[model samples]
Target: MIEGTDNVSREAAAEAAASSNAATILPGATIGILGGGQLGRMLANAGSAMGYRFVALDPTPDAPMGQVADQIVAAYNDRDAARELAARSDVITYEFENVDADVAAMLMSESYVPQGSELLYTTQHRLREKRAIEAAGVQVAPYSEISSVEELREAVERFGTPCVLKTATGGYDGKGQWVIRDSSESDEAFATLSKAGTQLVLEQFIDFAMEISVIAARSSKGEIKAFPPAENIHVENILHLSIVPARLEDSVLREAERLAIRLAEGLGVVGLIAVEMFVTRDGELYVNELAPRPHNSGHYTMEACRTSQFEQHVRAVCGLPLGDTALLSPVVMVNVLGQHVEPLLERLAVRDEAAERLNVAPKVHLYGKKDAVYKRKMGHVNVLAESTEAALDWINETKIWKV
Candidate 1:
């Protein structure tokens, strides 16, 4: 089990203590979700099985979560709709960090939002997120705030070539970022990104051995539990695969879990927080980013761990005891992007034959998305095996992804 820190601030400790005394929301309560994406769907599915009802708010009429839970088809900033959801729910939580911070703050003011808006506000913006991580006694890649092309060039000179420039807010899955491999590229990158009219941050790229994530769950009572580290691989900046029991030394993995729990305490998170970090060749861990909700890298936990992250999130927000996060198997979870959906469906149609040909049976999950646009996340497949290598080998043999 992962141990939490003793260094939390007095105010945070008091908040946790007070929250601990608050009423524990049992099953058969309504859970209000702020976003109606796949995470919301999965959370509803998990909570529904435990006898809880769910209401989701999203702009799309046919949002994925709408298929499983009661959905409010309205813009995230629609105050009336948010109010209606709050009135109908016993507690409110968001599935994604990009939800409007002001809306979250409004919900917190009038409803039972276990995961407060402060964490949401801090994480949605890259600059604030990095500073918060550093303030938590965790190290992040060296970075400088940039406001103009000149500042960008100066930062490039200071950090050297191969630095990254990213928008302060609103970008994910490889969007809203530019890699400046040479000083000459700074102006162009700046000019292109600055048009978005948002503040930018310049980060010194780290030459890390591997990227890993620790999904930590913290209840309002301050109880914390972290799942096993997941070694992640990305293709074009989008997560492609997450392998459990990250291929790192035990000591490093322990340090990563410790840091994650510490950060959760520092931020006063009441639900799941996925901490992405870079492990240097020298075994140093540097926090890369934070998601105050379920993360793509944590998809492996649905089938690999004793408790899925979805169920854990529900427990954390509803003031229930955190479930055991022990790893039950060595697993590899490969994403099925939009382009691969048809091929995956074809394979699924001949399940027995495909399993025989590949010599492995992978548990496939498809989000009920209507369209299959290129690069869009359609679903994922979890391959549990005696070894992660064997699972990865099966994924390769299938030739679904380049691996």
Candidate 2:
């Protein structure tokens, strides 16, 4: 058994052996995906470029990923559907971490899954993920589990005000989280979140100088490669922009990459892992969280890196040689939320200055969704230039993208 990981069941070990032995699932084979979101869509696009077909199992009908690949419209927990998906593909991976790990384990009975279920299990819950990071000798925020109102109060007292309270599971994009700025608001926040009947974790909020994320990929052959760190800006918990080659001291950048690589190896992950980190005003670094798949912060890699993260994930899971993660240019990727969709579409219909300039050159990707809801990610635009500042300036100049 690998240190810092849960003991693998006999069934899981057999699956790993089968996968490792079947190394080099060359192009033209099908790759099965568990979730069909934007990440899956991008994954399918990358896999298609390599002559590999993709099939996704997601509950949402006509999901973004489904638009690009064959899809099985089934709940992630449906064992029969999972089995069918595994049987039809050369190997399997997931787009998101929220998929049931038990289903992956069931698939392990026969199918080969390079990105094992253990990573999904560890990262699905906030407390478990933090524990795993700490066990790997990584620094994380001080946190405590809160199951009851009293426990929540106690944690609030210990961590003090301005700490964050988050559900142990099923939370993302700022959902299932509350910022407790005062002791008095603890009761209300706890009551509101507890209504969902889930355990919560109270975390000490670090006053970080900046937010950054590193997207790293590990091949089945144990080769690891990391993209340049991306400085992230979030609006109401949703990523607004990602600027590659983050403005940071050289030592800090190197440390971020080192920590990310260390975490990926410690987890024994074969696919991509995005490590989110916080660099304190005092220059101390702390692991914020882990996403065991391609990350939104890495969207810039599509145009800026020698190997896009999406393609890297496909290569890693297929047992192919890992691609170079060298940066090709400074880029800024800005998320296009649903609220901006209408304005963007309207602008594109006419030959206005914004539209005309965008015609000169634009890298707009719109996810085909049925409805436009505020704060929901509809798509993104990547601006590449000589420098990060230049790219961001161009992005800002695009009036239609000023969401």
Candidate 3:
């Protein structure tokens, strides 16, 4: 579904990352990953297939990954626990970026963590990430750092109303953010958000035509491969659905791929990097945010692409040959929030009748989260069909939970 004249060919991308002396990690190596959420769980599943074992360091006991891989039950910042995990692992990678990057650097002196801490440090902070992106010669939304209410007010005045104020660290899924649609809301927004003492960044709101994401991987050998852009839809700041082969013009799709490649190369990311972007009505693209691991948007790749992002990530970190990123089918991926789990399971209990009624195969993925709370990502359903529209139709028909 990609269109455009300036697309980077897959062969050209592989060549750009070519290196003969690059470290080649064979199968059967134990891979240690930080954070044992669903990303770690999926990574473990993918690695296990290639004969690689996995150990995850996470604070959550009985974490999703614990169901599949060995679990080092400890906080990410626990040096002793990290040391234990590292001692048993051949090479380490991480699923979440919010963990202590300094601790990661500390571990680098003792073990082989090819994915490096530099990308984590740069991406974990909003201001720092924007600076890094701009430094790489990429475009981002007009933004300014705000330290105080006065600063927030001034930035609001300059950027105009209808801008977004986000915490510089520890915010996701619509949390730790405020939308100031009018000057009058500035004080309340700043007062409410700044109480936590985290630094903040205010960005001018772009009336984007669509939100899209490009998931790409970079191997230890410097190989780069990008999945086709995914058009994303968000509800209340949470990702609700992802449509692959994004319904974007060829030029915009090509640009998204180029930007993802640039970010992976420029950041020296050894695993996967998901670049979320905004495509304006005028067809201009702006980098919105970056995730230094497998992303929710790329979940469709599990069923729709020749290589899933999880497997590609395992290959990249293991220094194995990168897999092809070609799409196998049109797909729509819908998030299964905590609220959706009960109803979904109930529907499933009814047996083949529900599937027959839906008239489509829904590849359900339950993360095994113990509790289903509002807005928490419990799992997802990847609907594969002949067309994006059909997949989306099935998704709408099958979604029974009230989000």
TM-score of every model versus the real structure: 0.96, 0.92, 0.93
- What is the overall TM-score of model 1 with all chains considered together? 0.96
Models, CA RMSD each:
2.7, 3.6, 4.8
Which residue pairs overlap in candidate 1's backbone? none
The better-scoring model by lDDT among 1 and 2 is 1
User: How much lDDT does candidate 3 score?
Assistant: 0.89
Alpha-carbon lDDT, every model? 0.91, 0.87, 0.89
Runs with alpha carbons beyond 4 Å of true place in candidate 2: 1-22, 347-361, 401-403
Candidate 1 per-residue lDDT over residues 1-403, each given as its tens digit: 2246454455666775667675578999999999999999999998999999999999998899999999999999999999999999999999999899999999989999988899999998899999999988999999999998999989999999899999999889989999999999998999999988889999999999999999999987778999999999999888999998799999999999999999998888989999999999999999999999998899898888999999999999988999999999899999999999987887777645545654555999988999998999998999887788888888877788864
Which model scores highest in TM-score? Answer: 1
> Ten residues in a row with the worst lDDT in model 3?
1-10
Q: Per-residue alpha-carbon lDDT of model 2 for 15-116, expressed as tens digits?
A: 467556756889999999999999999999988999999999999999999999999999999988998999899899999998999998888777988787
Count residue pairs with overlapping backbones in model 3: 1
- Over 107-191, each residue of candidate 3 has an lDDT whose tens digit, in order, gives 8888988888989999999999999999878999999999888998899999998999999998898899999999999999998
Pairs of residues clashing in candidate 2: none
